[model samples]
Target: MSLPLAIISYLILGESDTWFTTLGTYLYFILLPVFWVGYTVGKKILGIRIVNLDETDVSFWTMIKRQLIANIFYILTLGIGVIVSAFMVGIREDKRAIHDFIAGTYVTFHPPWQK
Candidate 1:
């Protein structure tokens, strides 16, 4: 959802291929806050949340770093990053991916009202 929005935004802005690489960077800033607030807006909507490896709420800086790392991988690979990210999450003890590891965070399911 967020990815599409970003692409659409770029298209609307008439960005060229050369500027494509920068889109991920822009999206990082755009999404970082959303991710930091409660793991992710999507996760929040889905009744899930992310915490740190230490079992505390994830910090804003951590989310920013995670977004930076994940978006870099995402841009480098055409779209393979998603698959890699999924596998990493699936294999992680706390259901975290490369981004989470870089940020020292863990994702977990939560009840809606609790959010």
Candidate 2:
């Protein structure tokens, strides 16, 4: 999604700093997951999705917390948090990463229940 937009942006604007690129990045990485059953394009392709632990739909704020707030910890820890998160997901019984705990969410292979 961003790739085509980036190519076009570069062609037209001669740089990737345009609003189109920013919008494409945010739409694909953030908003899409909030509205698209919690699955981004890659996650959907991988047959997994994020879900709230309470079995509710993942809200916009929750997605923000997951995507933005949790990332702060990852950055502040000099990326150790990210490494720990990967280990936790691999070794923990619940298979949850730090972001999942912070956002009260989990990734699951089970498809969301249709209305």
Candidate 3:
């Protein structure tokens, strides 16, 4: 999703290639500590939010670890790892993907009425 969005941003912005948007998007998501709002814009619209394994608020470093395990390394493998991770989610009762396992985080529903 992030990579696709970055590619779209790159195309819309008249960029030469996806490198800039991809790298920038990766850096922004991985390095920044976007707390409080666990969901990105799309996730918020979908009522999904990322949380720690213990259902606690996550810190900056935790997000970093998440991005590394779930996004960067997985994506670096030409999406093979991400595909496997998706299967992990489907096979598990808890629905935690490999990324969730690696990052010590999971996603939960955010009903609109709750917040």
Worst 10 residues of 3 by lDDT: 28-37
Clashing pairs in 1: none
Pairing residues by index, what is the TM-score of model 2? 0.81
lDDT of 3 at 21: 71
Which regions of candidate 3 deviate over 4 angstroms? 1-14, 31-33, 75-78, 111-115
CA lDDT for candidate 1: 0.64
Q: Against the true structure, what is every candidate's RMSD?
A: 4.6, 2.5, 4.0
TM-score per model over all chains:
0.58, 0.81, 0.68
Better-scoring candidate (lDDT), 1 or 2: 2
Best by TM-score: 2
Report the error of model 3 at residue 51, Å.
Answer: 0.5
Cα lDDT tens digits for candidate 3, 4-62: 66667767877645666766666656544254456666667777877777676556777
Question: Order the candidates by TM-score, highest first — what do you get?
Answer: 2, 3, 1
lDDT of 2 by residue, 4-115 (tens): 8889899999996789897777667678878898898889999988889976778898888887889889999999999999999889998999999889999888788741
